[model samples]
Target: MKKQRYALIIIDMQNDFVLPDSPACVAGALATVAQIQKILETCRRIKWPVIHVIREYRADGSDIEITRLPEFREKKYCVPGTAGCEIVAALKPASDEYIIVKKRFSAFMNTELDIILRRLEIENIVICGTQYPHCIRATVYDGVSYGYNVTLITDATAAQTPEIASANTRDIRDIGVECVSTFYFVNNIAVH
Candidate 1:
């Protein structure tokens, strides 16, 4: 069998979501940085396409979701030109890598992600990064809906709590998405 063409997508690993002191921090996000970094390194070594998907909003909250607007006005995050909107330093995209900025939970929503993936002829996507229930879940489901094989690197992804992560993982797996740890994914890639 031929090795499937795929891309590694690192989603929402930004200061606002991953830093412990950031206003929008996800409790478990900080811990997954290292795991995400590991996967990033492996992908870079293997010369795989790496796409960094990030969330960004206008400082005035003009582009923020209507449901999040009230809170966002008070506690702003992921604002453009701000450090909080940047991808965490540890997993910064290389000069040749792609960065997709999204204003919604799903990276594919109104973004050029699908176009880029299609242009690359990518059939599978290995996803990782912060907060499972929202961004991760949305992106994974959308990937499936778009007819792409999706793999969620469980350890490289995070949620506010382990319980939340576990629950989301089960739900994601039930959809036939491959959910594996960073180690397992890296090893499996090696074997192929």
Candidate 2:
């Protein structure tokens, strides 16, 4: 087997999602910024790939998921060419890092993420992002289903409420997916 390479997959930490008082907000999202940024710094230090998975939609909302299409048509959370679509300032992608735009919850759904990861020869994916029950969970499940070693950084992800976040992380842990805290991952995985 080939050597196992890894990448840091940051999902949907755009202005619309993480910034406080945005049109739509996940209350716990903003709290994760510091941890995510710290992990990004480690990835940069190690020269590991950082794949930023964002969400962008057309003005007419043609590309949005059905569940979110109404909101998109009305408010346009992450429309292309808009400030909302851009990644949060604190966790900005460097010139060398990659950005993957997806219209759905899962970064892998209808996106080139798999192809890019394959091309980069990434075998282990460490994920951290907003809204634990939705985007983070979906991406983690998809990564595991695709046979990649998936790790979810619990402290680096959040949901609208502490209860929701706890439930989601418990469910995620109940599954076979590896779940770790930001401190544990940074201490143990950064050198690999």
Highest TM-score scorer: 1
What TM-score does prediction 2 earn?
Answer: 0.96
Q: State the local distance difference test value for candidate 2.
A: 0.89
List the lowest-lDDT window of 10 residues for candidate 1. 183-192
Candidate 2 at residue 79, lDDT?
76
What are the clashing pairs of model 2?
none
User: In each prediction, how many residue pairs overlap at the backbone (N, C-alpha, C within less than 3 A)?
Assistant: 0, 0
Regions of model 2 farther than 4 Å from truth: none
- RMSD value for candidate 2: 1.2
Minimal lDDT window, size 10, model 2: 69-78
Give the C-alpha miss distance for residue 115 in model 1, angstroms.
0.5
lDDT per residue for candidate 1 within 1-192, as digits (tens), equals 766797999999999998988989999998998998888888888888999999989889999999999989989999989998888888888999999999999999999999999999999999999879999999999999999999999998989889999999999999999999989988995244
